[model samples]
Target: MRKLIVTEFISVDGIAEVERLPGVTWNDEMQRFKEDELADSGAMLLGRTTYEIFAGSWPKETGDFADRFNALPKYVASTSLKALDWKPAELLKAHCRKRSGN
Candidate 1:
């Protein structure tokens, strides 16, 4: 069985949506942690917002983080997206449910 680990970033006030938070950046420790975590994961599961954010930016960026992010297989849960053009990406239908322990 495979383990499903959900990783997220939230503000100190418990706000999960931080796309507009200014001066917010991942420190060295956080970067290292993220790199290590991604290294261990074979696939990435993302919501539509996050998937779009990454899909728009990571493709044009160059670095270890970008390389790892673009290289990993991604499964995105979205109801409105017509297509996922990001290479190695799959679009999950609205009725689909993410499962673990398979």
Candidate 2:
């Protein structure tokens, strides 16, 4: 079976928010960490909201990260999403299930 890794962005106080936290610095260590994580992931599994955010922004972005993100196969698990225009996308109809804490 393929390893299903679910990476998430959360606050220290336990809030699920996708935004740059205040006072958090971006450094080489963080970049290397992210690179390592993504290196192991063959594709991206995203929810509707995250998919919408990435699909809208990553296509216009440029750089190694953007290139990698845009090129990876995206598996969007959603019930209401009817269409996906992004390349290499697969819609997992009604396959989205919430995790324990999500």
Candidate 3:
């Protein structure tokens, strides 16, 4: 089975809001963390906001961070998006659920 990894940027206070993180202090660490999250992931699970932010910036950049991010298959969760202009991405269809009866 494939796995979905979610990597997020957070503040020193542990907030994952992009607007909350500023400056270049954690740039290296964030890139490293992103790489690590994608290391074993066959694909990624993301919300539309995350996808837009990533697709808008990473694909235009040249670096290790861009390489890994551009390569991974992304499954974005949304219904409003008509289509994606980016490669290596698609709409999420279904998700596995955990059962208590098992």
Candidate 4:
């Protein structure tokens, strides 16, 4: 079975928003970390908002990270989204539940 790994960033106050916090900025170390994590991942599972955000930006980006991210299969969990325009992307299904007969 394929392993599922989840990565999330949350502030100490429990804010899950993606917006940069006050006095914070993106750094080379963070970029390297993300690159390494993406390199280790075979596929990406994203929620609707994240999927939309990524689809809007990553496709326009160019580089190793963008290349790998665009090439990887993207599975989005969204019931409201009617279609996905990104290449190698599809709506996620409840495969785990189906497999376990839950």
Regarding TM-score, does 2 or 3 come out ahead?
2
lDDT (Cα, tens digit) per residue for candidate 2, span 38-84:
88889998878999988888899999887887899999989889999
RMSD of each: 5.2, 3.6, 5.3, 4.5
Arrange candidates by lDDT, descending.
2, 1, 4, 3
- Number of the top candidate by TM-score? 1
Give me the overall lDDT of model 2: 0.83
- Model 3 misses residue 54 by how many Å? 0.8
Residue 72's lDDT within candidate 1 is 89
Alpha-carbon TM-score of each model against the true structure: 0.82, 0.80, 0.70, 0.79
Candidate ranking under TM-score, highest first, comes to: 1, 2, 4, 3
Clashing pairs in 3: none
Instruction: Give Cα-based local distance difference scores for all models.
Output: 0.82, 0.83, 0.70, 0.82
Where's the lowest-lDDT run of ten residues in candidate 1?
17-26
For model 4, how does the per-residue alpha-carbon lDDT over 2-59 read when each residue is reduced to its tens digit?
8998887777787777565334677999888998898889999888899988898889
- Over 44-72, each residue of candidate 1 has an lDDT whose tens digit, in order, gives 88888889888887799898878877998
Residue 17 lDDT in candidate 3: 71
Please report how far candidate 4 places residue 55 from its true position, in Å. Answer: 0.8
TM-score preference between candidates 1 and 4, better one: 1
lDDT of 2 at 1: 75
Q: List the residue pairs that clash in candidate 2.
A: none
| Backbone clashes in model 4 | 0
Across 13-101, the per-residue lDDT of candidate 3 in tens digits comes to 77677765555365677667767776766766777788888778778988776687688777787766667766788876344233478
